[model samples]
Target: MEQKDQLLQKVWLWSLLFFLVAAFTGFVYRWGLIGGDILGLRMSNVRHAHSHLMFFNWVTPVPLVFMARHLMKTAPEAYSSLKWCITVIILIGFASYPFFLIYGYHPVQIGTANLPFSVMLSGLVMIGWYWFGLIYLKYRNKADSSLSQLFYDGALVMLVVSSLGAWGVAVAQFGNIDNNLISGALTHFFLTTFTEGWCVLAAIGIFYDLSKKNYSLPVDKNWLIAPIVLGAPLMFPFGLSVDLLNESLLWTAKFGSLLVGIGLGINLWYMARALPSRNKVIWLFVLAMLALKVTIQLSAVFLPETLWLGQHGLRVLYLHLMLLGFVSTLFFAAFHTVNTRSSKAGVYLFLGSVFVLIATLVLISGLWPPAWQPTNVYRWVTVGAILPSIAIAVELVVAGYSRFKQG
Candidate 1:
């Protein structure tokens, strides 16, 4: 038990480091928005680095650690395999940051061959996921068929399936496919399924595992898994190049969006019911963002004008809501359970920054009333961006201090 706790603790701290770096990269991206250039980095490239680090390092590892720990409880013999898989995943994740930051998917000449450095690195990350998935499958039968297990299995399937979308992207680039529809569809598919499918499912699964003792009401086994599996692939249409989509693809995407909304709504309802008696406030905030995220998606699909209002801006808003708002906050709450010494000042600052960031994004998206629009939109957003990093940095300081005292 001590060993398991130590492993989880190490993994959790590593994730926090990733989160801090990603947050600071985000700060840089926001600075770029306000015309602040450092080291001649393109905003788009910096953004690619920031977002990938968040997905590959911050969000991906924490959930895997929890799920792997869950499996270890049931199948002790699989411990070494799971541990090594996680180690590889973290290494690959950290190694990926510079490739993306420097190259951003552009092909690099390696002797005679021109290779996309980040793309190759992304492929390795995908392999790491598959490696983890296989480990889960090997020990899955030994584990009980419970809600958390259902979510973990489904999340792994999505993780594998999402890789196909990434491969599609590589094929499009390598084959020199010129059609906007193909490229746009593949990109959105990869982004949507990985974020909505893998991340969301994994988070919910972690929640169930972490708070299982608090769950009193019974949930139907299939209710949570079926909708996401059926909907997420088709749901990519929501962010595709709408101009390139025909009527058939358009309606299909909307239908998928509806299914996804229903699935998330069901999960939220049950999760809300299962909330632990303590930390209800933070849990509710995360749930609210999840609710708002889907609601905005559905609206974007059904109302063409609504999509127009924030099409570009809303996508950014949506990703943050999912990654930072929903997934990151949930991770923080989970960490708080293990380390009660986390700074309250840091926690409040982080939460406040999230809401401020969301608000500025909504305003920037043209979703807010014209009268309420700020004169300098970029300035507001830059401030919003800076706050989260400051908050995270404070937490890191406290964590380091605590560890030093322990040592």
Candidate 2:
């Protein structure tokens, strides 16, 4: 049983590695080293590959694997089938990344073929998440009353909703064959729903669960349910009405963001009070989370059209801060904390990665001008990339060693 758990953990870790690599490639492309034309299909292909790999293969799967192992501890009979479902989901998600890369390069011709692969992959993920959600719900109902149980239940629902939103995107791509408007609507729906609803909420749930493992605190019932209760009404209308994507939709997303941010703030404050005064790593993680929440608020207000930053650059920077700086860093910290033999090393790795990530975003968003000065921008980005890669590599090695020693 321990061996099986270790194997699953490795799979989850490798998925994170893949996500980091994909994210780095995206940063490189954004900096204009790899792709020649910013507007060309090749750039689009790379972006597509980056998005799927980061979200599906990297972010979503890691939490799924962690939750699955937890489930196996109590409900061993369900383990085999859940593991199989995860394997299928990962394989399909992996296969789709290359297809996205190809489609990006040959947008007009290869996209047709690529769309089917994406559809199939999205379908598989939805099914896998459904199974996982059912398992979580079953476990939550049976488990002892705890904050972790609440988080598990909440994350499962977010996962299912996110998967369904992804499927909506796949369907919208099909809509593109006839009308670009419908396709655009679906794409927007997918982005907002997945990012705000599933990705962010699930990350919070994981953080909540990890916090409970370390200290006892009352779960904020409002924060736990705010994303779904608010996000659903905000996102559901997007599928049915194309007009919601215009300007009015911003209010809903902003409101949801405010609620989530307040909730996170309360939780983090509680966590800080609970932690020992010497834990700088946890403090850094909390600050990163606050930064992310602030970034989300900025994006909600200025995205697709900020005065100084422009729409394109602001969107990219917003995503970078939230995903790498906020979500990924917290996850790295939590993982290191749980597996404490290398906790110090893990904190170093996480902090180093975050510093590089922030530097990269600042250069990309603050330095670049519309007139095209690529020399200094590329150099700084290249330098920024090195820190995080080395940090994450050290983290992976140390984590592997710690796990092995335990075995």
Candidate 3:
């Protein structure tokens, strides 16, 4: 049992390494696209690959593994199946994503739905999470009552819900619904639910667990759960109706964002009190970046023109803000606090975050006109991007080596 546990730990850690490599490659390719060309790689292919690997392979695996570890501890009898389920999800993600990158969005038809290789893998993951849900439902009574646990439960549910976006595309093929708005909205639905719902919930749960373990900040599972849980899923309707402009959905989006803002503000307040012992600067930056992420998400309701940005190139900037600025930073904090291992990579993480932010800012600034910017701003943005890539690359190596050394 002990050996198997250690092996599982290694698999999860190695997944992080793979995520770093894939993310670095993706960002570099993105910069290359901006800078006219890098090695003549196909931009679409790289973008497809980058998003798949980052979304499927890297982001969820980390939190899933951590959450599974906790579940197994509380319900030892279910350990064997839980372990296998997670391993299978990881393997399927690792195997399937490269094909998507190479094949573009090729989702084959089967009955009422298209079954792309990527979507198939996602289906398998959804199965894994179903078992996860079962574990929770069957054994939750054995666990203590806490908000963290509720958040974790919500995270698992959201993870399962998030996969439907891919399946919806498959379903659309059969339904003969091929309009770009509806299709794009569905895709956005998945990304938003996964990021704002599953990822955010897991981060909160893990953050709470870390703080409780430290026994310093008396973390409470307060009424804030109301807002967070209520808000996260409500705005998902926004994605389905993004272009249609329904009055009900528009108002729902506004209300949902308000609830989310309140939930997030509460979390931020508690987190700020706990910040001194955290990798203070990095965590605070994460909070700020998270605020920015929420603001961007809600911008469509506030400034209707914002809805158009997703189809525009601005979508890339939005994704980078969430993936790099918010999700990744909080992920590191979760690992740091949960494992109680002090790492020297905070500086790298912080600097890399700043570089990525600056690159986004510069790129979005529209290069501001030829005379005022003189030098090609896209080229400069690419240059700034190199810092984060290098810093993150180093941070990956440091994290992997340290974990390996400990094992």
Candidate 4:
């Protein structure tokens, strides 16, 4: 038990480090937008670095750690493989950050050979994820099955499906393919499935497992799982380049979006009912973001013009809402559940900063009236970015200091 606790804390600290670096990179990107040219880095590359770092490192692996804890209890024989998988995943994920920031996905000359370092690193990270999935499958029969397990199964399958989209991207780049439709579809496919399918479902599963003790009401299992698993792939191509999708594909995406919204609405109802009364506020905020995300997706399905006109800004806003506002806060609530030593003030600060950051993103997302545009939009965004970064850094430092004193 002590060993497991130590490992969990180490993983948590590493997650915080990754998150802080990503947040700082985001701040730099925002600053570069305002001040032009950050340390001679291209804005596009910096943006890629910030986003890829957050996706590959912080959000992807942190939940895996928590999920492994539950799975470890079920199938203790899988412990060694799970540990190594997560360790390699984290190391490879961290190594990819600088390469992405420097070159995005472009090739780098290495000893007279041009190598796509970031893309190669990303491939290795995906392999680690696959290994993690296989370990769970290999040990599945040794464990009892439940609703949470069903969700994990779906999440892992989505992860694999999302990787195919990612591989398509690498293939297109390597083959020198010039078709914009293929590239756009593949990129959007990967982004949507990975975020909506893998991240959201996995977080919900983790939360369900962690908070199952509070449940007295009966829940419909299939209602929660079917839509996400079947719908996420269909919904992927509904992004910026809708021209790539024919009418059938577009309607498929719309139907998928509708199912996802309905599924998520059901999820929100259960979550609210099962939530412990003590710290319901943060979790409620998390649920609110999830609801708002569903509303936005439904609007895109019905009002197609908004999707085209506000593609850049609205897309950015939606991603932030899912990643920062929903997944990050959900993780925070889970952490508070497992580790009561986390400070309340720190919790409130993190929560408040996340709210501010989401609000700032909405203001700049072109959703508001033109007359309501803030003059200092960039300044507001910068401040919003800084608070969460600072909050995370302080929490990490405080955690380390406490461990040092204990040692």
Candidate 5:
């Protein structure tokens, strides 16, 4: 039990560290202290590190840790080995990412050049998925706790699908494939599977776990399950060709985004209504996340028409706002809740992070205007970036200390 607690503690520490590195890189880059074109190899290298650290190091570990709590109670062997494997892989992956950044290699290039390391990392992730799936299936068969069991089952399925999609993308990149269709399909499969599938499912699981502890809102298993049901088939044709569905695909993506927005909005609204009147921090955080979602959908609407928005910069801004503002903030809030027991300090940390993130998003998005001068825009972005790093660091320290003391 003590070992399990320590493992989770380490995961939290790594999450915080990687998050800080990403935040710092964004701050420096925006400030012009890092001299390079945003689309150049140098910037791509940094962005690669930023994305992997955020997704694998920070995001992936959260649900694994959350699931660990339940697995420790039932499938201790799987939980223990999974933790050890994940820890080693995370350390190795983090260490190698900096080298890739320094050498200005694309992630695919890095993965191929360091095949052994990549294979080892992939094996570790596979072990995590296997163990997590085994535990989830075992618990579901046993049928003990209905709430968490359902959440875990959903998460496990999403994780498996997402992992398969990732593998397909990797194969397409590394394998000598002459077909553009195969390559394009793999890329789309990877993107939507991770962003829309795994991320959303894990988030729903986290929300279920957190909200059930604090509020009496009803959980609709159907709402949690609906995306996978619709997404699986819709993603099939969508991945084959964007032009296949043509205008219909555009409408489908738009409508899908709307449905997602509405579903998430309902969850947040329920949470807001259920919270005590004194919990202003959660309220504000919820509002910020909802705003972030709206921005994401709007960005999607603008994405296919890149000629109007200078495809590269606007797309970058869209991704940053969605990943950094929406997803990261929600994860931070959940991390705070779990680590700090919903302490006032935790609340303050969350609120502070959201405030800074909102400011950063506005500045970056506004910089998209054609008439906007680069110098002034970059200055504002730099200033905006610094605030969020400070806020996140403070939050992590406080939460880490709190968790340590409790343990």
Candidate 6:
């Protein structure tokens, strides 16, 4: 058991290092988008690099560490496979994806088979997910079939499912297919399942896992499961770029938003009661941002025009709410659990959270129909985005120098 804890501790540490890069990429992405020239590259390229590295690299793998806790308990072999898979995630997600940034969209060919860098990375992800999914299935029925586990299971399935869409993307790109609908559906399918299923559900599961320990808070399994599982899939229409006219898709999108709202709403109620007493301000800040994300997301269903908001400034903001606000915050909580901390760490985390929150507000304010955005708002957003990077740097240093402690 001690060995397992120690192994998981290193896993979180490695995950955080990759997250540090993801945070750095966030600053670069925002800086590039806001008209700054750092690498003499277009914002789109930076955005691609940022999103791929952050989402596939940091967001997916980090959560696996948390999920592994349960895997270790029931299926040690699965946990063993997961450890190696994480190592590969670090290679592809951290090492290779960043390499893609350095060499953007340039696909190498072997025997007339053209391969996009993303396509290659996607292959790696599929391989990782195969191992992950198989590992989970090994003792899934033997494991607890609670809401948290349900989300974890769903997320595992989605990872494999999204990889199929990813392969479709590769096929389209390689075939030089210019058909918008084909590519768009493939892209949307991958993104929707990944973001909603893997990212959001995993974060929700982590929250439930954390909440289990709090005497003041009790998790309602049904509340966590129903809306997210049922409603989250509906939310994917937002990712579709091809068809906004289909009545069925439109209504499904709206209903999905509502269900996601209720699910997250239930989460906030329980988390609110539990976090404060634990002095988990970081968790509080993240859960609050999640509320904002769902509210804004679902609002698009009611105020259909709000769908246009993503065109303005909400795209990156929405992504951040899920990536940093929901996903990374949970990782931070886990990191704090693994490592002993000093007062300086708390201050760093608090200030970092404040900056990130302020940045979100600033970005939301920058949305169209209300353009009184703060002058040089990008600079403030950079500070907010980079602050966490700096905080993580400190934490990484502390973790590296400090001895392992009990969870």
Clash count of each predicted structure: 0, 2, 0, 0, 0, 0
- Model 1 spans with C-alpha error above 4 angstroms: 110-113, 212-219, 304-310, 341-345, 403-407
Model 2 residue 27 distance off true place after TM-score fit, in angstroms: 4.2
Name the better of 5 and 6 by TM-score.
6
* C-alpha positional error of residue 133 in candidate 1 after TM-score superposition, expressed in Å: 0.7
User: Which pairs clash in the backbone of model 3?
Assistant: none
Tens digits of lDDT, candidate 3, 58-83:
77777766666666566667666666
C-alpha TM-score for every candidate: 0.93, 0.80, 0.82, 0.94, 0.76, 0.85
**Once superposed on the true structure, which residue ranges of model 6 sit more than 4 Å away at CA?**
33-37, 76-79, 109-114, 213-223, 241-248, 273-277, 304-310, 338-354, 357-361, 364-371, 404-407
RMSD of each: 2.1, 4.8, 4.3, 1.9, 4.8, 3.5
Candidate 6, 231-344: lDDT as tens digits: 766666666653443667667777877887777787677667656334376666677778778777767767755446336456556766676666676666655644445234
**Models sorted by TM-score, best on top:** 4, 1, 6, 3, 2, 5
Model 2 whole-model lDDT (C-alpha atoms): 0.61
lDDT of 2 by residue, 249-294 (tens): 5456556555555555665666555443344566566566655656
Per-residue C-alpha lDDT of model 4 across residues 1-407, encoded as one tens digit per residue: 35455566778888888999999899899888888568899889999999888988898888788767767776666667778888999999989998999999999998999999999999999999998988888877665576667777788888999999999999999999999888888988898899889999888887776765545546567878888788888787677364566777678788888888888888888887777555678778888888888888788777855344435777888888888888898887777777666565666778888889888888878777869877887888888878899888887887666566656
Quantify all predictions' global Cα lDDT against the true fold: 0.81, 0.61, 0.66, 0.82, 0.59, 0.68
Kindly report which residue stretches of model 2 are placed more than 4 angstroms away from their true locations once superposed. 1-8, 31-41, 105-115, 176-181, 212-220, 227-229, 232-245, 275-283, 295-310, 343-347, 366-375, 404-407
Candidate 6 to truth, TM: 0.85
lDDT minimum window of 10 residues, candidate 1? 305-314
Whole-model alpha-carbon lDDT for candidate 5: 0.59
Highest TM-score: give the candidate number: 4
